[model samples]
Target: MKFFDELKARGIIDALSNEEELEKKFNEGGMSFYCGYDPTARSLQLGNLFTIITCMRFQKAGHKPYMLVGGATGMIGDPSGKSEERNLLDMETLKENIDAIRKQLGLFVDFECGDNAAVLVNNADWWQGLGFLEFLRTIGKRFRVNEMLNKDSVKSRIESDSGISLTEFSYQVLQAYDFVTLNKLHNVSLQIGGSDQWGNMTAGTDLTRKMNQNQVYCMTMPLVTDQNGKKFGKSAGNAVFLDGSMTSPYKMYQFLLNQDDAIIDALLKYYTFLSLDEIAELDSKTKNEPHLRLAQKSLAQEVTKLVHGQEGLDAALRATQFFFGEKIENVSDADVASIFEDTPSVELSSEMLNEGGVIDMLSETPLFKSKKEVRRAIDQKGIYINNVAIEGPTQTLSKADLASETALVLRKGKKNYCVVKFK
Candidate 1:
């Protein structure tokens, strides 16, 4: 399929400026394209994943892709889609962030290849050297204040209690200047971003045409959300970071694997490059056995492999198996620790285990409702240690019960697993 056609099929084409003209330019082949990333944080979130992948796809289709890290504009945060003004980053912090982002981008695309070789750019390179008066004369004069006030990003903030700042209000003009710079220096013809960027992206296209009388393309991908309409890419109030240090590979794997059934199809379409035939088969399998969650697993595998690589993907799969699969009894303590590294854990003193009964530990540690409940569970043979059933009614804990001299795995039922670490 043609690249744009594929984009539409995958539901990645949320908006495009002058579709026919853009298609004509794309047909010319070897066109230049660019995507921007703001260094608002130390690491990019999963929300940034699809856009970076889109840039890679453009390169694969024989177009040059330039990845722009917003070093200059990042210091002055974009007011687009914001409810309040963002604090500006210091120049030193922004430079460090830019370098970190560039390293992360290198893992996905190559830079040594010719023609369609991927390029890394920092907008500060140009934005820093320009005199304030000169910028106003050249780029600033092209944009009208009334025209800027009408964009949705600006209007929403204006209508709210948390008003926009002048610095953030000028974001569209700065972004437009990014497009103009890329077009002039690299011959880039297209700019792509999330749906939130529609107004700013169009501004870039308009500025390029008016300033140099040249045609450019603009496209955006829709916002991703869960079945209940909650946004994706966040875990427990924090964003799921692409960097392993920020978010572990195991956690990233689980994020995709646990996707709600309603959102899996859309996610598969946007994230994976699975062939149409393969996707159809997966879809059929899903319809036939929704409970099996085959499609969700496939989506998780493909995405995990793409972002974290094979080793990371394997660790994630191992984690899944240890958590939900059979043969838990055969697993090692080290493996269990690896899988449940970030989970809530309790620490108990060895002396307490030796002097106190199982009931006392269960009640005192808040693992059970009461001593009576603990007795009932024990009577039903539901209490287990390291997947082995306990036989003694007067079971007294000892150092030997601790796994690896410091930890004990508690299994209250088939699914509930807890760990007690010795201090």
Candidate 2:
């Protein structure tokens, strides 16, 4: 399949400025394109991952990628997807976020490859030196208020209870100039963004045409949404951040692992670099044997490894094993905390270990109601301390049972887990 055709086939390309021309250009040869991200938070959300992967798809097809960190535009706050004005980000936070995201983006695209290697840029690099008056006269004059007012992003804000700010109103004009700048600097011919940013993207194409006399193009990806059509991101409910600290590898793995079968295919295509044939095989497995959850497992593994490294994937897999009643070994207190964050927990004094055997201790907590209940569970080999069934009702507690420094993982069965923490 042709490059553009395959993208459409996968539903990667949602809107294009000119389909025929863009398709021809895409097939012709290696060209330069760009995608922008704003430093709105300390870490990029899963929604932004869609754009980064799209850039990778183009880069693989022999195109150069210019990843523009919206340092300048972020200061003004793009009104594209907002129902209300966003609180402006401070310089310190924005710079910190930009640096953090730069490292994350590098993991996906090759920076060492020769001509088509990825290049990172900050709009602040250009905007920092230019004075306000020069910006207005040079780039601002081209955008007319009436046309800007008609843009869906702007129009929606105008109709809202809190009207758009002048700073936000000029965000499109600033972003539009970014295309011309990239075109002048890197000979970039195309720009891509999420569908919600179509208006902002078109403004860039139009601005590039008028300012630089370059027929640059814009394409938008449909918002990476859940099956219910709600936009997927922090605001969508769960803040599935790419950063490990904000959202643990276990949580991230669970998010993808629990994806609905209805959208599993699209999730696989969008989130992973697995080939169409590989995805097709998974799709078949899903239809024929969804009870196995092979597709969800693959999707979880691929994305977790991509965002986190091999070690993180291993950690997520280990975390998964733990939930299924595997013995916990060599895991840290923080990891243990993350694994059973949502499960019930029973805290005990470190002194209690000296007073009780395993059954005596188990009976004290809510894992079992009484000593008799605990003994019966042990008789059936159904009770576990750190995933090891008690040898008998008389099994004693010891320091060796602690999975971490001060925590012991307790479970009644495969699904019921409770953490026993030493106070």
Best by TM-score: 2
Candidate 2 per-residue lDDT over residues 1-423, each given as its tens digit: 778887887889889999999898887659899999988888888899989988998988889999999999988888887888888888898889999989988988888899899999999999999999998888888888999999999999999999999999989988988999999988999999899888888889988889889888989998887767777776556668999988889889998898889999998988888888899999999999999999999999999999998999999998888777788867778888888899888788788777468876787787788888888888888877788777886666767888988888888866787888887
RMSD of each: 3.5, 2.2
Candidate 2: misplaced stretches above 4 Å? 353-356, 359-381, 392-394
- In model 1, the worst 10-residue window by lDDT is 323-332
- TM for every model, in the order presented, reads 0.87, 0.92
Global CA lDDT of candidate 1, please?
0.80
Clashing pairs in 1: none
Model 2: residue 191 alpha-carbon error in angstroms: 0.7
Query: Positional deviation of 18 in candidate 2, in angstroms?
Result: 1.5
Question: Candidate 1 versus the native: TM-score?
Answer: 0.87
Top candidate when judged by lDDT against the true structure: 2
